[model samples]
Target: MATTLAEFEAKVLLDQTLSTNHKSIIIPIELQEKEDSLPTNRFNKLFKLLIIYCLVLLVYPVYLGYAIYWHNINSINISWCEGLGFLLVVSTLVYTCLCYSFVLSPLVDHISFDIRFPGSMEKVIQSNEVRCAVSSIIILGCIIFLIIDTQDDRYRLVSAGGILLIILFGFAFSANRKKIVWRHVIWGIFLQIIFGILIMRWDSGRDFINCIGSKVDTFLGFTDSGSSFVFGYLVDQKPFLPTKLENGSLAKLVAEEINNSTAVKNIVVFKALSTVYFFSFLTSMLNYWGILQWFVQKIGWLLQTTIGTTACESLSASANIFLGQATTPFIIKPYLGQLTLSEIHAVMTGGFATIAGTVLAAYISLGVSSAHLLSASMMSAPAALAFAKLFYPEKETSRTKSDKISIKPPSEVNVLDAATQGASSAGLLVVNITAIVIAFIAFMSFINSLFEFFGDQVGIHNLTFDSILGKLFIPLSLSMGVEWNDCEKIAKLIGVKVVLNEFIAYRELGLLIQNEELSPRSAVIATYALCGFANPASIGIQLATLNSLAPQRQADFARVVFRAFISGNAACFLTACIAGTLYNEFTYVQL
Candidate 1:
């Protein structure tokens, strides 16, 4: 054994000497041997190819069914060129996928397998070149199809093209183009379309969504019961109720109408803001019991699997659908320090892209469709991550060590303590919301007055801030499928939501719905577009809140605020696009 070991050491030393002397000759022979022994899984490769083929085959019939049904129902003439363009785009996508899976992937692996230092500049350049090539091919194919298909309806084509232009505009303004992953963008668009089809296009999907919405509405309606108990008739929409008299006689009791009554005091206080407190308290109890966390986790898993974001990012983003932006970071608070800048961007953007469940009751009270609101919140999860990545791509390596999330209960010893704390927190939110609304409304009114005075000199009698905003955002609104006549109106709401807050936008939207100012389809799109907290005010809130959680990352938080705001708006618009595309104006009746 000692002799053999000595012989092995001698041989190793001899080989080292030879390798140093003849580096080029020895390296080439070793590399050739390594290349010959490279691992290849034929079974796995064949199985994946087979699955792709099967999916394509299955989707073809569904596509045909939809096209045939739509054509028959609408009785619209289909041009041969349009049909050909659709086929060509579909074929090109499949061809690209096949080529990448079968050719490019293997070739790249064979060529670059021995390359070390994955983060080296050379590797990054090569990877970017390949990505750019693939993206260019796909984009070129889509552009060709768009040009071919647009030969018939120039107006519709222009609107569609405008939407595409908006997406490109976002990509063009990305902070880190090299870090932007195309897979996230592509999957994000696909997910939005799938959700739109499921919730807006199909009857079964609509039914499911409506049923869930009804439950949400019913749950929110329960808040009225508590409000009525404490605040009497002020919070009751139907204050009058039929009662049984003491003499075994039925009496129809009617409460006096409070709509125009100056005697009615504290109506808005009890009816609007109080409901937020009740819902928040209920949510707190659910969180303490682990119910809310369970649902958040399930949704987070879905996002993690689909978008490939970190567990912390996915959890916080998913939680935003149910909790307020200020409250959601607490779920992943411990891991905040470990999160990358992109992850932080995603968290903030996701928070801004969706409203809290506690406020859902307040919006529902405004007479918006509960189903649309719920769907919008749910869909914003993936949309937020997708757009955030596109705008501010993840450049830093993640430091998170765990995939599992364990949410600590709210800072309370008992369920009762949690409830009380939640109520107090909610009270602060109510005061802030109430004060902001009153102040902003008055501010906007003052601004409009100045605008109106200036417009009077210009001979435009009905000039206002909303009209100015409307003019600015009309192209974007029209691109989202709003009717030309209604584009300005919807644009005003969108502008208000971004410039001010979602509450003001929702208030205006409620008025639009009440007065029938917008078509049902347009209303649905606007509901989705205005469902987020992507206002200028949220930037301060996000910065303050997140900075407190991870003071070490204050610089990162500040850096991403503007990008996060843009990403949040893009997320809402993406959701709006899905809703607009799938929305059948004739079939949809406003609730």
Candidate 2:
């Protein structure tokens, strides 16, 4: 009887229902004494649909593999990398299936049906048993590959193992639940493939993207001017206006001088630029200040253009969270209360996957190459949206009206209000940045020192964190096409990004570049690897920000935020790998 009902339910879902627009149908099962009629036509049609869907998935992986191989034709001679790239592309699809099979479908069921399962069995399936199982198997495969990679250190494998362990635990917590649905799993994979293709082609036309980027920058002038006013007021002691910094031929000359000049040789220009940077920082800070919330709202109005630009390019929700996790979304505050779960997920994922405009300069100072930061920011946006939506499938909710946002003047009565807010905000940012960086560096140093002592005592002379990380995560990195010889350095770089932030990692990369420690290929790989905010500290920051906004959901936010963090990190890493693999042929060009 139960078997019959299961079949009936499957038939109903497969036959006449399944479209997103008309999701009102439900398949109910009944236990009966007699046999019931079976619809052979419906069954055949359903089977054909399933086959077509599967075939579509198969095509994507093939296309992606061909793309990677074709792009990197000149650099790699071995056909194995092409096979491996295809496998990874397929793996991504499989991972997407498992994610939706276990994670998203359950969420959709809960939101759409208000069906919450309290028992362990249902909860386990809903949480992600299939996903975890698949992830674990992949981890084992990676471990086996590492064991055989005797010529190379095993850091990437180790790192991958750790990631798999986390997934294993997630699986343990989510076993055989009633919420598991196989079809949505397939759908999610399709969506991922679509976005992957889109992202792969995103930067193909530099001229067009740059042209659009300039227009967006031009629109940015509105908020830029306001921000400049605050900075100019503070430094020049007068009301100031924001001006565009052209990167034209003459501007390039100035930039070159700025880059090459000794500390004493060009003090004037340096001081002026430094002053501008400080003010820009200050204005950014004030956008979130209490009395200056209105200014933020106003800036958000001007920011709509930037938002539009981002959306037009199909950037992710993290773009909203980049600078300040809490404030960026507030730029679209009117929509916050009404955002669908999918939109909110995009917002959080984008925040986790990327940094903000204010800190982007600092990352440049850290040693991250200009090309790296630019590419990362652009790539991460769409990737974040795609991953976030998959990780936390949205429930139905009201959509914000189009152009619902408008700029308004700050509520403060005078300039004093603006000044105080800007100063305080900047001060807070300075303090936060200083504290996190100092504390994190100290902790890393301590860890490194411990490893140093143990390694030296045991006669493992070159053993360091990077070495260990490389030994552990090298397979994972290699799978991303990092050279076997360079995996350890890359592993350490990934560790730095996860422990600290992309800024520090990029700074390290910059040093590596200047010192010529990396081949251009390895450098490119590292740039992609470290292009996100996927560390433990970011988890805490995100939780705190979300908590402040919806104190009641703090516990829920904390619980889910960690998962979001993992997904965010994975998305960034995967994107980096894709970028590296696809662009492998272009490395002969000097960066």
Residue-wise lDDT of candidate 2 within 510-578, one digit each (tens)? Answer: 788889888766777677667777777777777777666656655556556766776667667655654
Spell out the clash pairs found in candidate 1: none
> lDDT of each model, Cα atoms only?
0.79, 0.54
What's the TM-score of every candidate structure? Answer: 0.70, 0.51
User: How many residue pairs clash (N, CA or C atoms closer than 3 angstroms) in each of the candidate models, in the order given?
Assistant: 0, 28
lDDT for 133 in candidate 1 is 80
**Each candidate's root-mean-square deviation in Å?**
18.4, 23.2
How many Å off is the CA of 130 in candidate 1?
12
10 residues in a row with least lDDT, candidate 2 = 263-272
